[model samples]
Target: MNDLHAVNTILADHLRIVLVGTQHPGNIGAAARAMKTMGLSKLVLVAPEKAPDRDTLAMAAGADDLVERASVFASLAEAVADCRWVLGATARNRRIQLEPLHPRDAAQRALVAAAAGPVALVFGRERTGLNNAELQLCHAAVHIPSDPAFSSLNLAAAVQVLSYELRCALLGDAGSAGQSRTPPPTAEVAAHAELEGLFAQLADTLDQIDFHKGRAPDSAMRKLRRLYLRANLDSADVRLLRGVLADTQRMARIAGEASVDKKIR
Candidate 1:
């Protein structure tokens, strides 16, 4: 085996290709072929509307093994729970708040996070693409700057593009100035599930304190998520934040009891 291929096999193993709500069964097989061509093998299907049939196998061609071993999940969160990094691919400029990265840059970022744990590159349906809610689960958005005059990219094509970029990233030449690969020490970075737990605790803490008062909490939580995610929090960071939230919730309960006693008096 070539030295580069040998090294990339390990890094690529940590990366997963996730497809959500795919409409056509053939696209699933095509997507598998794309991943296989670029040395990617892990495929995750999330609640596809249709089932794979004969056409699916026909499209897979020589990459049937990837399609055969693909993991299926009911939800995106459950699918990516163990991942430390996730990048959602979309063409439309949705109302999502995540920082967008070009395919080449996104590949670099994904590879870096692969050092710590599993990383996911998510692609949504062919028509509607990923919604804001699903994008929230991702740390960043991957956008391909195709011609605006004709931007309707196929699901399998999009996977092929991103997979190619990942392969180029592994080769360490992505055509971006100042582009370099230095896999940072990811020893302490929290896993995807850990970050999700922190957010859940934060939401509960805010509710206990009535922090939103009369306003909607979703907007606030969204901004807070961006802030924390940008900070690239580690395991110790999550623990500290969770500890503070627990204390705040405890204080809120105590204050609520005191208010009731005063009202009674």
Candidate 2:
């Protein structure tokens, strides 16, 4: 079994910055600088209005390498397709059903998710912010705390704030060394293929009950998958869940047969 603490440490070093539909090249440059300060290097730009400019290079300062090697994508979906966990930065609360996490908390959770696969944090455009459709693509939303009365923050400032929090969380505070001496307990976690099979069984049962009659089944299933993935279920937990599902399906089948017999009688 892999050491859980070591796994978390490696994951912290492998985070990615994903900018979606960014309009200003300067903000992109500034974001790269902020990411570099936190030891993050991977960057993916999705459908930006302008490519990197001279002004951006000037603003980037010592982090020119990060900006120069940043990959550009034609769509947000393509940008985060390989990422196991995708987080979105948003100031205004859309009151969507998604769980809201602060930057530090998000980073910590992202570390755990990254242990299983790659992780990406998506920042929206400066003007209108992430639309509902774009937000749906992310697994979770992160909100930075600001003064309630006046909470407007510049795009680069937001990036800096999140990056700073991530750096601190990954590095920890003064007493962190003592805490790190004793590693956290590790559990056997479920594999991706096992989770996929569980989800398929659950979806089949839901379909039998017509739970998704009025809803988009694919979207609903995807949301359920996101929620389960966020839970980070261990192998034992997965088995327990699958057992419960099997019992539920058996009861449903028995109930259906009894109803049919009554109707015939």
Candidate 3:
């Protein structure tokens, strides 16, 4: 296998970190240290309240490189834009209608997803945890197993736990040295524009069927789009759905013509 692909394979087996709305520079420093300790390097920061400075560098110690190299984004969407799978790290349930995974299970799933493309585990603010809006962006939520009575985890500690799980899942005891044959390149999925086009066609068909007349149909159509987007439909799937919409519109037109003929008779 090519060296670049092999290296990516190793990294792909691991998990990535994204700190959202982090409040303290020291915590960011410590989180970087924790990540490096487990052999993970990718760190993304989203709208951090404090800037990384001398204080952060001093705290990071040997992991200063990670702190310095971390990518900063103004928005969570930008931070996770390239990620194919996103996991939200939280102690309390955000209750945003997503399935919850324990840290270990989430790590395993993240490993698999990473092989296909970039994946991210997002950590929320030190104070309030991830909000419902942020949690909705994630494909799933991960809760570190802790005492229910008092389950708050320090930011660095949370990173350590999840990063450790990811490292173990990726490297095992022997480490990620001997793996061969790079996995197939992850196929590029359909873009949001393509999906939107399909949704528009679907809504047009629904209108032909009189499905959206009296009942504010836009809401229902939006929900349907959400459901499909969550499924991560590929190009082939989008084409198939478009074909189904075409057939539905054709049938609706025929039915309407037949009704007009009966009325005239």
Candidate 4:
């Protein structure tokens, strides 16, 4: 295949656009059309308010095939489970413990990640955007520098903006690109599922050891998650951490049992 065709195929297969809890069916269709124009085909929908309807088909026009091919999941976590890198697009100024990336910079990083494994750019619902929990699933937040004075961008328009940036990055026209983080050759960065599993084990282990004392573990878990995500750990790293957590849990259980035995004696 030619160079152009090769790059196109790689991007189409490796990079996905995920929409979480999209409210309007029409917006879904419009977003699909925007993706098609930028040579993107993979689309994942997470628990939309309603199934695609006539309005959706009307908006997609010639891009109806993308709508038909789109994968639907019950949750954003499930939708991005296989993706190695996930970036959440946010318009809200809400605080999240994730690294923020400009649209252009996000595109560059995404292209680099796509070489290692499937990468995703996640867009949340039209009305409210992604909640804190959903945003946390992403490794970074991608923000478009629209005018702060009038920053309301249409759902489809937002998709188009990111799509265009991705296309530019794919074509080697990304100007003043941000640092591109290449995944390690020894072991590519872990998929979303692996990272999530590590996070779960860490949380459970912390609980077993009474790391939180009486306080809720939510705040601490969030910080821990951010720390690990920033580490860009691969599958080996995840396995090693999980092993440590498992041992910690076992040790903690043994200590608790010994204490109980002493009290009984």
Scored by TM-score, the top model is 4
lDDT, candidate 3, at 114: 75
Model 1 TM: 0.94
Task: Specify the highest-lDDT model's number.
Answer: 4
Candidate 3, lDDT over the whole model = 0.76
Model 1 residue runs over 4 Å out of place are 1-4, 175-185
Query: What is the C-alpha local distance difference test score of candidate 1?
Result: 0.87
TM-score of candidate 2 against the unseen true structure: 0.68
Q: Taking the tens digit of each residue's C-alpha lDDT, what string does model 2 give over 20-119? A: 8889999888989988887778878999999999878888888889999999999877777656567889888774445677676776666656666667
How many residue pairs in model 3 have overlapping backbones? 0
Off by more than 4 A, model 2: 1-9, 174-226, 231-265
Candidate 4 lDDT tens digits, 1-265: 4987787688668899999998999999999999999999998899999999999999997899999999999999999998888999998666576777889988988887888888999998888999999998988889999999999998999999999999998888997666643332222788899999999999999888899999988889888887888788988899999999999999999999999999999
Listed per candidate, the RMSD to the true structure in angstroms reads 2.4, 6.6, 6.6, 1.9
Higher lDDT: candidate 1 or 4? Answer: 4
Per-model CA lDDT versus the true structure: 0.87, 0.75, 0.76, 0.88
Each candidate structure's TM-score, on Cα atoms with residue i matched to residue i, is 0.94, 0.68, 0.71, 0.95
Better of 3 and 4 by lDDT: 4
- lDDT (C-alpha) at residue 235 in model 2: 70
* lDDT for each residue of candidate 3 in 1-265, tens digit (9 for 90 to 100): 4875576456654456999998989999999999988878988899999899887887788899888889999987677766667788877754465567767767766776676667889999999878876776666678888988888799999999998888776654323322222221244655435656787798788888988777877567656754775677777888999999899998898999999999999
